[model samples]
Target: MIIRVRDQFDAYSTNTNKVLEAGIDLKTRLFSEGGDSPYANIIAVNSKRVNDPAIVALVKALKTDKTKKFIKEKYKGAVIPAK
Candidate 1:
């Protein structure tokens, strides 16, 4: 069945044993198509809050290599870090 990359992870979790047996393929356009996927995890900051220390820190933390590594390890190919 057609599903987004992130949603496929959810399907994988629920159908870990059945996926291979059922012959279901979960492929993501992000990797296969070599083009940008419309889906993304965005962090929108308000104009006024852009300079807030907490917001700044949060954004910094999210963009760190450590965070990227965590996302890569935890989500496998399901989630991609923003560039």
Candidate 2:
């Protein structure tokens, strides 16, 4: 039997196949934006100044404690910065 729904609810609720992204609990994040996956959110810029000092500075800025905290708070464990 196949029942079409609006979004991933059918998959999340196990109303359909067991190939859903959810676990036993109703609140489980298997694969988030930046939890621990290789293929995840990517920040890329195609420009001649890609390797410029400004770009390096930008990356360094993202490693600050405040920035990390902000991401943690705002994203609520949904996004994890690279190591």
Candidate 3:
């Protein structure tokens, strides 16, 4: 029961099916077990203006200790927020 990346956020948190791991997560496991990674996993944003207070606030929030703890606790490492 593999789900696509586009549907994971909804399907993963709510759907009855148990999500074993994401493809990237599997690759991370393999990489740790001495196999090459299939590819890199990452997140990015392309905001037109980086100076907006909302945007600044978001970036700031994302880097904070509270936010990092919240993400780790809430997502349980399924969503790895970059440090």
Candidate 4:
């Protein structure tokens, strides 16, 4: 799966557009068949904050919950996707 975060911009509209662009770009790069597993699911997240530590923590928490739900619904045999 993928996670994307936005950066602050001069305007909220422009920032949102940039966030979408960045998310698409990241998804393409990370999921490209020549790059990584093409079957892997992609997840996009937007955040204006620019702190790596905070982002990491947030991602960890989100992954924990999301994984549980995903396993329960989608893949009952696996707790999480193999990275």
Question: Model 2 over residues 31-72: C-alpha lDDT tens digits?
Answer: 333345665444577788789888878878888888888877
lDDT winner between 2 and 4, please give it. 2
For residues 1-83, write the lDDT of model 4, one tens digit per residue. 12232233332222223434454433332222322445545445566554567777866765686766775576333223434
Worst 10 residues of 3 by lDDT: 26-35
Candidate 2 clashing pairs?
Answer: none
Please report how far candidate 2 places residue 2 from its true position, in Å.
Answer: 20
For residues 1-83, could you state the per-residue lDDT of candidate 1 as single tens digits? 33235354632342322443444454522232112766555789889999999999999999999999997786565456776
Runs of candidate 1 with Cα error greater than 4 angstroms are 1-35
Would you estimate the TM-scores of all the predictions? 0.54, 0.48, 0.45, 0.24
Ranked by TM-score from best down, the candidates are: 1, 2, 3, 4
Between prediction 1 and prediction 3, which has the larger TM-score? 1
**1-83 in candidate 3: lDDT tens per residue?**
44565355532331211333333433223213112434334335566666777778887887899987887787565455455
TM-score for candidate 4, residues paired by index: 0.24
TM-score of model 2 (CA atoms): 0.48
Candidate 4 deviant stretches above 4 angstroms: 1-36, 50-55, 62-74, 78-82
CA lDDT for candidate 4: 0.44
lDDT of each: 0.59, 0.53, 0.50, 0.44
